[model samples]
Target: MTGAGGNPAPSLPGRFGPSFDVRTVVVEPGGSRVYDEAEWRGAIVLLERGRIELVCSDGGRRAFGRGDVLWLEGLPVRALHNPGREPAVLLAISRRPARR
Candidate 1:
């Protein structure tokens, strides 16, 4: 996925350009968490199993399940709405340069 004006999505893997950091994050089911954009850069949160509720900065919340891909924009993440019976595995990739 690309950003405004066709800018490529911030990611770590690449043929060229600055490489961003990548990490795996796991969220337990029936749990909710929040992270700011300053903390988490652009990331593709891949849902491995169970369910995850995603809440954007604009108060938008949605649930995603296994094999689902979620694009995390450089904005304040409100919460992770996971109301399932299992844990949720997420691959969080932070690729934005630190603010000076």
Candidate 2:
């Protein structure tokens, strides 16, 4: 994601384990970013505040606002755009298979 000054946002910091991980991200207004779908295979995204537009690989676009919960397992998310004037806060929860 890009910050207010057009600089890339700082890397998300979070704890990871064998089965799960969680991260919080904040996108500045007009900021746009992309993520590797394979890296987030079984994740769920929770929109905490503000608004964002999610664009899929097939060019489909969907807008989400505060309190919206999205499942990302099947959709190929190509990009995320913050369209609101305020920052957009989101929580990403990813589940992983148990390690052998």
Relative to the true structure, how large is the alpha-carbon lDDT of every model? 0.64, 0.73
**Residues 3-86 of candidate 2: C-alpha lDDT, one tens digit per residue:** 345644435423444466665677788988785666456667778778989887889889999989887656677888998998
Candidate 1: C-alpha lDDT? 0.64
TM-score of each: 0.60, 0.66
Model 2: clashing residue pairs? Answer: none
Question: Candidate 1 residues 20-39, lDDT tens each?
Answer: 55555656657776765544
Instruction: Show the lowest summed lDDT stretch of 10 residues, model 1.
Output: 8-17
Report how far residue 58 has shifted in candidate 2, in Å.
4.1
Model 1's TM-score against the true structure: 0.60
